[model samples]
Target: MTVRAGREFLAIPGPTTMPDEVLQAMHRPALDIYSREMVELTETLLAELSKLFATKGQSYIYIANGHGAWEATLSNVLSRGDKVLVLESGRFAIGWGSAATAMGADVEVLKGDWRRAIRPAEVEARLRQDKDHKIKAILAVQVDTASGVFNDIEAIGKVIKECGHPALFMVDTVASLGCMPFEMDKWGIDVAMSGSQKGLMTPPGLGFVAASDRAREVHKTANMRTPYWDWTEREGPEHYRKYAGTAPVHLLFALRQAVNMLLAEGLENAFLRHRLLAEAVRRAVAVWAEGQVLGFNVAEAHERSNTVTTVVMNGNDPVSLHRYCKEKCGVVLGVGIGDLQGQAFRIAHMGHVNAPMILGTLSVIEVALKALDIPHGKGGAEAAIEWLGESVGA
Candidate 1:
């Protein structure tokens, strides 16, 4: 008989394990939509959200997912036929650009090596070539979770400044925010978008957008603005505009608790912890790769993401490996998406994950590799243990 025990571990890149504090915060009954308590929660939550993004600019919360945030951002800043320079580092950025296209925005994508981060020099050169300044915005992902590659958003911003480009700098931090160092204001990001599920340690259904004064100013002249996504109307003094109507009361409570936990732990500490865990995972993967059957999808070490690690299986079938781990070991792993389908898998080391949790995931993966006779070097778990033991914190 197949036997499995203990809590099933979810190691997917998104919809990460939520902290008990957040779950408990959302467990209660919904509050009155217009009550003073709700108003206070809304005020405190928006203020803290601003601090979370490291921005003094206005932030709006929506009862939508990251896709909605992408659409909302496009509508708020671009009009029909406006030009946007999209940096295609991976699948998601292209998806964002496609959303812009659907909104009647003209998108010019800079095809990049899928395995590496976008080169700042290339961005600078491209912007310099646009002497007429036709590009209204440059859209990129801080970390392309699909490829497990992290781009330097700050470097991109600096390049834009070097070229003297007036285009708005926009970044999608859906997978990187709270897991890594992302300073929206410090990075000179005119607009930034993120979702609640990944690094925020909250349930899905909440989308966040932090807009600088320039992005808001663009909103005034932006012809594509719709009532639901109009930044001015949403950010107005009216309490009803907070959610464009009644608020997602319980989500606000959960977010408040999650933000409190993150602040208490300190954002830097959180980033370091995620970095250390990701390194441990990498070390383990390195050992496994010694058998020459496994390899990293991302070729460059510096470009690797701190939130997720995508592993190439060479000739092995990723679907079978994922199925074995889920059914036999009760460890859920992220399936490869886009170009990586059937060939790669992902290990997420973000959100509320800790050493023991990651160690358990590594151990299970090692066992599955052996059980399935997948060619892998011995001692992957040992390598992970050694690396994790060397440092108490990062």
Candidate 2:
């Protein structure tokens, strides 16, 4: 076995590689939480974050993960017996339902297969069935990381509008934030949640929520209110009181820098880059799956996520190939989570990922597949090469 060395590439869906600019920005010594510089930095971040989310609504930053954001959003808008509709495409949707259930809310799950996205027609059907309109909120993830499925949030939003349902549209964009084209305000999304790990190109430490005035009003009248997760106190006059205590100084530093880098590249350019990068991976996998090797978990091309590609190994053990690619070739691929465990692998092309990095990952996977006697087509790598032939800086 030949040992490979250099930079060990970490290509998982979240906790993506941080840009040099963000790292450098975070390297400096911590500042006083109430310092003028800190205040300015925080203000800048909050203002710019709203733009990044494509929301003109209010934004709040928290020192937690994506799960924490879920809890905060649920607690803020729900009363004890409020009915919430969870649109399920994969694991994350179910997780949201469970969280709402635990919070003493009745959750109605509109289930879907892992291979496809949530159907707008199904959402309409459910809304139509709720003649009394008991559903208070519609919870969903724009991109489900587990199955690599991208739902049509815009179309679903349109359905909700047509139904005239009085439900808040809450979206989890932890995986899709900066990597995909998400227009929270344009799509009529009431509340949008995200984490710093995936698309912000930062180390994981922060969770963000962008809420509309209506959501804020609902939060003001919510049950089981806690001082910490309360959005009103967080947005009050005493800015330091928002965090409830001392802030995560270094993480804030990283976030400020990360958001800056994203803005520098521009959101439109970011979306285009993510789309092209994802297509390159899809081209490789589609051609490879032709010979009965590896195929995408999401069946439809339009429904697949631009952030990550979940690949099913048919009857083959994907774990073995994943290990070979990591230990032998220095590429760390993501293992399948939830139901697809041991049967599939994921390739993340979101946030700070480029053509050379993608090509490097693909080359190693092809070599490992052949070494393991895995049945696959010969030109998967070539296909990706041709896709990038035009340009990567596109």
Candidate 3:
């Protein structure tokens, strides 16, 4: 006997809950890929992509995912043996560096732990050590979902400029783009890459990359350029070249609606909403952590990301709690991956999330703890409610 009949709440990081408006927009007949309507749609989305990324640089749409955008950025400005410095705060940047390695570029990792954000001073030190500027590019992620860490892209970019380093500063905004503030041009980001599945509130499939004029100038001599991921090929006169082949018409429809909703809400308001919801989750988790078994994965309080919260489950198996939440309460939480796997569980408050969705997830988590006999402080959900009440006002 359980009450898990309603629609299951998805609290995972990426591939977040799609809005009904976006779904409705996709429920339509296919359009001619060569027609004027299709060209207008493509042009509108391309211009909007640059706006979302906060850049004056040219943006390209790709028929791929975040991983494919990684390759596109690397192949555009880097050569066969170009040295790339990966500022590792968590799994994704290291994974991006690994992709560079596979593509025949030499990769060096500025080692960092999952418990904290990347230190800007350490990045400056590393850049200063590269006397001859062997490193062609620096890679980082605005947010890493696995560790639930948010890196300071602006600070890192500033340090790169301070050191007078010529390496291109590339960022992966896959998990933080629409949920927070990211100024690609103002922050000195030479190349930026993102996906539709996270903060953008769209389904998985489309990838985007914005390149600065400096990066584009370097692209002329890049040795790793291939026809498919080549930036030049995508900037052709034909509409088909924008996507390398046939366009993803349905996904584009969904994305356009999603972006429209984001703009309507305003980016600053969306950031505040994500911040408030994330703080509510943190409040509940703080109460639960009184049991000593449940705690935050990030050591510093400020380092905790507004998009997702990683809870460290010590001495207790997170899988049991996850099972109870799904089977009995119809709420799905994000399972930790990479280095934090088996040791943590994440609560995502990004994308199409509101106060009730976050509060419900927190309530179900509290129920799961009680049902599983896991040691946790009582009134975790009530704490979340109290926080939202005080912060959100009336």
Q: Pick the candidate with the highest lDDT.
A: 3
Model 1 is weakest, by summed lDDT over 10 consecutive residues, at 1-10
- What's the candidate order when arranged by decreasing lDDT? 3, 1, 2
Candidate 2 ranges beyond 4 A from true positions? 391-394
Compose the digit string of candidate 2's lDDT tens values, residues 24-114.
8889898988888878877888888898889889888888899988888888889999999999999998898899999899988997899
Please list the C-alpha lDDT of all candidates, in the order they appear. Answer: 0.92, 0.89, 0.93
lDDT of 3 by residue, 44-98 (tens): 9989899999999999988899999999999999999999999998899999999
Candidate 1 lDDT over residue span 345-367, tens digit each: 99999999999989999999998
Candidate 3 has what TM-score? 0.99
RMSD to native for every prediction?
Answer: 1.1, 1.2, 0.8
Model 2 RMSD vs true structure: 1.2
Of candidates 3 and 1, the better by TM-score: 3
Off by over 4 Å in 1: 1-3
- In model 3, the Cα lDDT at residue 70 comes to 99
Best by TM-score: 3
